[model samples]
Target: MVGNRSCRIAASAGLFVVLAGTAGCGDEPATQIAAGSGTTTTSGAHWQRLPDAPLSPRASSVMVSSGTEVLVIGGQDTAPCPPGADCAPGRITRDGAALDLTTRTWRTIAPAPRPLLGEQAVVIDGVVHVLAQNHGPDGYDKPARLLSYDVATDQWREAAAPANSIGAALTSSGAKLLAYETSHEQGLVPDRILDGGTWRDLPRDPLAPSFDRVMVAVGDERLILFAHELVTNPGADKPSIVQAAEYDLAKQTWRRLPDSEIIGGWYWSHTDGLLVDPSIGGADGGQTGNYGRVYPEGGIFDPRARQWRPLPALPAEPSDDLWQGPATGGPELAIVRGFVLDPGAGKDGRWIRLPQPVRGAAEDPAAAWVGDRLVAFGGTVHTDRKSAFTADTWMWQQ
Candidate 1:
């Protein structure tokens, strides 16, 4: 998550922040929250613990949909060590398992053919697909492959790898899966889409090389590109030049969206037409943990309407660990701080805060919608020697 303090104050106008305790702008919910981070909701939206995961504790794994179950795939495990304990041997593993949401059980699937350090996964044609990855500091230079898991056959296979996949990303739209690297060679790599079983080049993105850029799938036929264009030449001294653009898939042309006027980073994720910066306040607070955190702030880009709404400042949070994604079970997007309802998704625009995961915080955890219950598991926290690995399973009821 990354951000800047400069935000348009009127971003949340006319939108209701439907939390229990306070109303930032619009009408408040009738249910009076009893505090404790809104952990217990009168509306039956609460957090609960599931059985401990059978899969090994890990982070940065591929968690994607597989028929009626949620599949957990390859990730690296860094065991939290004792104070000053040796932890130079943490390794990435290809192990995987499938969690049958109907029965809430796990069965080990065939391990990936290569190590799994991927952050994105999608299922195409009933097969689970993920990008293969390299590890440590040298991962940027090492070539990466594509891995697919055949659930029915319980087998794994490798495909042509993405060149310079360290900063690559994967997202699915309609029936097509896309892969692209944020940084390649001089600037960026041509965006690729999976056709049949092979990666095919799409059109070249229109933006010039920038310090940072990210693409987010808006809907079935549109992709939104957000970036910080690096300005050169004389008199180009502005601190920030945040940009947003849209690519119409049918026409295959890049059109510029309104300038967000905010610094951008890896924190952007979109769902249901809204691109959200999940965490903002503590992003640059300090070099240490989030003890320097302030209230949350981020920009929300609604490309469909050519609008940008600044996220309303929420109450002070203890930490700034937010995992944002589509709440496939409902019209809302889930962030650890709370859930955001998309006004266009048959619900009123609202923000609902919830309790932090009682379990220790882990970065890059895997979460997916299993019906109305959101299942999340497997992420790690390295305190002293990059040690603690979380095997705990947590679920949220929508």
Candidate 2:
């Protein structure tokens, strides 16, 4: 669906940029845009709404930059109409759109070759590589669903699917894209590392629980997995503590880090963005696992000390305000978290929070850093109306 509308809402004081969408009026509908450009209104600690063509509402989708353009794909829209509250956001959309980041303009692109709901993608070597499974009412199953998009050619083609059928929460570390399938059914514990057209399965950490989790690439040689069990079962004592561990690809080993050692908040889906310490020489030295900081709830992890350290404080108070509703609403507001690592050590890395929640609902969010900017996508939410998702795209500029 295509839409066109604009409004210059107040950001800080008088600084107002154009916000085009089907929202900001009436009951306010969930809308998205792939195109538009404008000047910055407020200077610091503020998000100036960039001009953009309206996008159809989608939940749990993925968006990333290819060159100067932004690609948004796969999200369900839940807008209630005459058919009760369910008519608001419409339906799930597999279509994709391109927003020119430099020009601030929008253009609809070819739809995804296949329809995907809770899927994710990463860009490497100038190619947009996507890993996903088919989402049906029953659940997801393994299929050959790997694909890649050529930004230069404006075309979509096939890539290798994951080694198994069902998986969620995808991320990239160094040269490899990592993904895992969460299952309690049988002995099926699926995890794969895809690189240069190869898939390698690493051993699961015995301490790691079989629950929903987030996977992120920290530094060059390590992968971090934050595991969480939302609800305790019948015999469990209480809600379990969310656990974090770093995996070294070179050593093919997993090192579990104590919660007190890291300085970042536990992002839903364990979706903490990883920035490498540029000061370290090559990928061999410095803090090996995760050097970047975690946000909202401040903290850090020291690879050399083999321990976790707390950070300063959150910039905003934890409450439910309209503009600050992000903090309490769907997991969307939680997206903002303090990140540590810097690609170049010459530059100092500090803990900074994202402006929004990476996940739509309380579900974990998925994230990847392309260049200096961090790209986050997808996440589930349980609301009063019904369980929903989000495909909103955001870029964290350093």
Give Cα-based local distance difference scores for all models: 0.57, 0.44
**Model 1 C-alpha lDDT per residue in residues 40-124, reported as the tens digit of each score:** 2445465555665578777656777676888888777764444445454368788888887667788888878877764577676
Model 2 ranges off by over 4 Å: 1-45, 54-60, 77-90, 139-144, 182-188, 195-198, 228-239, 259-299, 302-305, 319-398
Candidate with maximal TM-score: 1
What is the TM-score (0 to 1) of candidate 1?
0.73
**Per-prediction TM-score, please?**
0.73, 0.59
Tens digits of per-residue lDDT for model 2, 47-147: 22334434554445566656676677766655423212333334666677776756666777767787656455676666677775665544444464777
Off by over 4 Å in 1: 1-43, 81-89, 136-138, 184-186, 196-198, 232-241, 282-297, 316-331, 336-348, 359-364, 369-372, 380-387
State the TM-score for model 2: 0.59
Report the Cα lDDT for candidate 1.
Answer: 0.57
In the order shown, the candidates' Cα RMSDs to the true structure are 8.4, 12.9
Q: How many backbone overlaps does candidate 1 show?
A: 3
Q: How many residue pairs clash (N, CA or C atoms closer than 3 angstroms) in each of the candidate models, in the order given?
A: 3, 53
